[model samples]
Target: MAGIGFELRKYLNDDSFTGTLKAYGFAGLISAGPWVLSIVGVMLIGIVALTQPVVGEADGSGVRQFTTSVTWLMGASLVLTGLLQLVFTRFVADRLYEMQDTIVNANLFGAMALTTAVSAAIGLILALTLFSQSFAYEFLMLANFVTLGNIWIVVIFVAGLKRFKLILYAFALGYGATIVLSILLLPFGLSGLLAGLLIGHALLLFLMVGVVLPEYPVTLTVRFDFLQRRLIFPSLIAIGFFYNLGIWIDKILFWLNPGTSEAMIGPLRTSLIYDLPIFLAYLSIIPGMAVFLLRIETDFAEAYDGFFEAVRGNATLQEIELLGNHMVSAVREGLFQIVRVQGATILILYLLGPTIIGWLGISEQYVHLYYINLVGVGAQVLMLAVLNVLFYLDKLRDALLLTSTMLLSNASLTWLTLQLGPQYYGYGFGLSMTLTAFLGIILLSREMDNIEFKTFMRSRPAQEVAA
Candidate 1:
């Protein structure tokens, strides 16, 4: 509780209001809420699937049936969610590009409606297709529970733009309540946990609707012109496809190869043990945003302006040199801060993560993966942060290219690791991402130096003549 509170405060008190808001809202919706909630659902599915015993060996037939049902449920849910995301992304991206604040709000509301409808439909479908006679009641209840949370998560993110703090507060409360309720009801077993989730989401949705409807003044005018001009639809579609693929690839692997007695195939168990490492990996991002905020508004802003001016008209050598110094200084400062915070977080996770996992009723199989992955994740955060700073310094195109390369590298590495089997899976991803980021930073640094030197040479002659 104290840790969560501290995180909330850190975000709320950040100097960059706009950036903080965006980060807070995004983190809450995508990272904090949906990510965790989806994991819970998937974990449930995995556990239930594994519980099916082999007929000759145990209750094999029942296990097979349960696995089949969970598999179907996951597939249906994912497909529905993906479709909704595509539609919503198109809607929002188009509105945002045109600076159509009114239409954006309307689109957001429309998105909420679409999401609710989609989630509910998916829930119903799951109940019908996935729930068996024996477990039908339990499965239906679980479907409802996960669906309700899904709906609220999407709705809140869309409506959460300016009211960043509100979004954070809502998510913290919603998930916190869910966690508490889940723990409290665990004595009653899985059914109780499922019911608790349904209730928690229902309450959150009610609160979110009440808060957002009153706070926002939305208008019903939408124009897709801005998006059309940019081909944003295709761009977003591609990005979304890749993004989802990146996140779920590992999970897919695990589900396919969960080992003896486990139906899943991946190295990382979808079980409670994996939670610590995965959660810690996620937590590493908190400080990355902080470092980014500090660097951009201060050092990068100055460097960018100077770089732009030099580009528009050749800058003097002295001017370029000054810019280089400023950039270097900024990078150093930002990295120091990032390393400091990241180290602290890693230490805390190292010491307390096991205890937390136990408290959450997670099994012990995932501890090694969780801790190691968290470290790799932290290193990746640092690398990514540096890349982001470079981007802010008027290197958007290069940044985009670097990002593309990183994804490509990650894909190739992940495939190789999978071929080699579970031992190398996450390590490959972590290493590749970090390596790519470091290479990018090195290239950017050289470019910065060259630009600075050129600027100084251009300015030196003018100064000499003046003297």
Candidate 2:
């Protein structure tokens, strides 16, 4: 998102209220637009289903099944491709840095092909063996799963480029088609909805590829040289895996726990008590994410580059430390801003949450859970910002440890909450994130204080070798 952030920050040049609004609005849309479309679009489809069920069923069984299938599809895709997300991003960044442009497009195709093969193989296994659904449903789902995974990889590439408007347009058109086609096909039941999804995503994938592939010349041979031993960053791989796992582990625990969840489909269980509130709470993070992408990508990135550039150049100790201090302050201020922004958003949501839940026909009983998850989501955003800063600093070990902590704490504490009963349900996720974010802040502060020493010391061996 460094590329996206750089483009968005140009709005700040105005330094007016309108400018700030533009910056945030664009950021929110760019960052979370797809999310808004998915949530709201699915809800609309559900509403349509509620009003009139198909000929066979009185209830919106099709809608429920469709939603469940999609939920699982997204979960499986993200977790399956988690390692590639960071590792490939790092590969592209390095190749770009080294001015090896020709390597990028082919490697990207290689990655997409790799992601498709893996996701398809696993998806086919699960779709065939685990699911007892009709062949059409399974085939549609397998296709959608493969497309979504490929889309995720393309997003990583296009996000690194500055094609913000094109990205938004592809998202809008593809999802727009999804909603229209899904509603039109709703009468056909689950397979139809899934078919709608497959088409929309296929188009979206094509458009996304257009944005990226046209820019770089295509190389004849597909390359998987990125998987070579020297190019791999195991710490980054672990960080991506653990972080993605950590975020989902609590939800998985809830779903698999017999006490909390019931079977939704073959091998898939869902916790009605736990799922809705957390999903809604995630929507509340758009503002924080917008702010997050801005500060981290712009201010913190600038400071980071300055400090490192100063070190690599002929800057003296005093000069380097002064820039280091700037970088430290950037980190402090950025984290604080995220907290303040997300805190306000949380408070507003708290006051209005009951009404919102009522509007959605959700039980008022889930209100407390929603509020708790709100804070958890906020803490996760803060953790994400911290992780981004850590990544920029190349503090991969710290990142890996923090992600591991989140996974362990969320899993264990969530299990404890289940034992403690309904009132404590959402506390586990909230508390885990809060604990991790606070720990991250402390670690970051300490790391910033000693970065210069470590930077110079680490370089000393290379310096000696050169001499």
Candidate 3:
């Protein structure tokens, strides 16, 4: 992501207001491209379905079901891949640092293969048990799950490659194909829609794999050396899982709650009170994400590297202290920028809530939920920035602790809010994230203050550690 940031910074060489805007705008598009495109593709499918006169009222229900199925598949696949994404990223980064390129490709293939097999088995079992009435739907569902899981694995590697433009193009192509194919296949209904998605994702997986494969030395041998190696941090895996789990926990609670949720398909449920508003609110985070990548990658990262480089060069303590202060300042400014930008975005969206909802043809009754959810998602961006700082400081335990708190808090508070009724619907997610962000800010501040001492202590030789 920092690499993407660096690339984007080139666009700001002139430093004019328009240039800065262009830089960040492009950065946001590249950063949020894949998920935003997916959302658009799905929404287009729904819109097309709703417009079809021959389908009548059933079209709306079918569109809802299709949307729910696709959303569920994406959420579930993300949870599964989250367990491995960070750990694999760590492993790959370590290998690259050591110039062990051959094993990187081999291990990546091994990971994707493992994920595909597991996803396939799970998808098959679920299809068999849940969708017995329609074999075509079951097959399409299974294919989508497997393809999407593999695509995530491929995407992680591609992201590491830092070819932001190429990645953006690939996503555009894939989702473009999906939208077109889905419209063409709409007459076949949900299965056809899903088939379009599966095919599109399969193409995406191919393109990403192509981008990733050429970087490594040609090797056919599969290696699960990462699994065998103890170099991976357990906390990294925990943080990845907990963080993603935290993000979705509130939604899950709402989905399963009898008062808020209604059955969508085969034991799947949707929370009418929670889902749409939150999803729309999340789309507003693109600018914040762009700024986050820029500030962290360019400003904070350079400061971090400079501080360490100065240390390595045996610079004076005063110089090191100055560098450390610079790093801290960079981080603070970065976080503040993210908050300010996202806060403004939230405000803008809040003010336009009615207009947007009216345009979408959704009830104005959802406006309150949308406003609250916007705040929650903004806090989530802040929390993520804090966690990124922790990662830079090698505070995996702190990151894990914060994410765990977020998960537990979201789940418990959401359940409580459900019991409290509809007026409190979005407060659980908003309050939980706000609380976690507050804690994260405090922890991050303390960690930055003592970062030098901690880094020195951790870097001492093993024999010196005995002393």
On TM-score, the leading prediction is 3
Which regions of candidate 2 fall more than 4 Å away from where they truly are? Answer: 1-10, 55-57, 162-165, 459-467
Backbone-clash count (model 1): 22
User: Which 10-residue span in candidate 1 carries the lowest summed lDDT?
Assistant: 260-269
Q: lDDT for each of the candidates?
A: 0.52, 0.82, 0.83
What does candidate 1 score on TM? 0.59
lDDT of candidate 3? 0.83
The TM-score values for the models, in the order shown, are 0.59, 0.93, 0.94
In terms of TM-score, which candidate is stronger, 1 or 2?
2
**Poorest lDDT segment (10 consecutive residues) of candidate 3:** 458-467
Per-residue lDDT over 1-467 for candidate 2, one digit per residue giving the tens place of the 0 to 100 score: 45666667778888899989999888878777777777777666666766655712575555666677788787778777888888888888777777788988889889998999999999888977889978897789889899999988887678767566677788889988887888788778777778888888898999998888778877667889789887788877887778878889888888889988878667878777788889999999899988886777678878888988898899999999999889988888889989999999999999999998899778887788999999999999999899888887767779888999998999899889989998899999999999999989887887887778977776433212210
The prediction achieving the highest lDDT against the true structure is 3
Q: Total clashes, candidate 3?
A: 0
- Ranking, TM-score, top scorer first: 3, 2, 1
Off by over 4 Å in 1: 1-99, 116-162, 179-189, 205-216, 219-233, 260-276, 280-332, 343-368, 383-426, 439-467
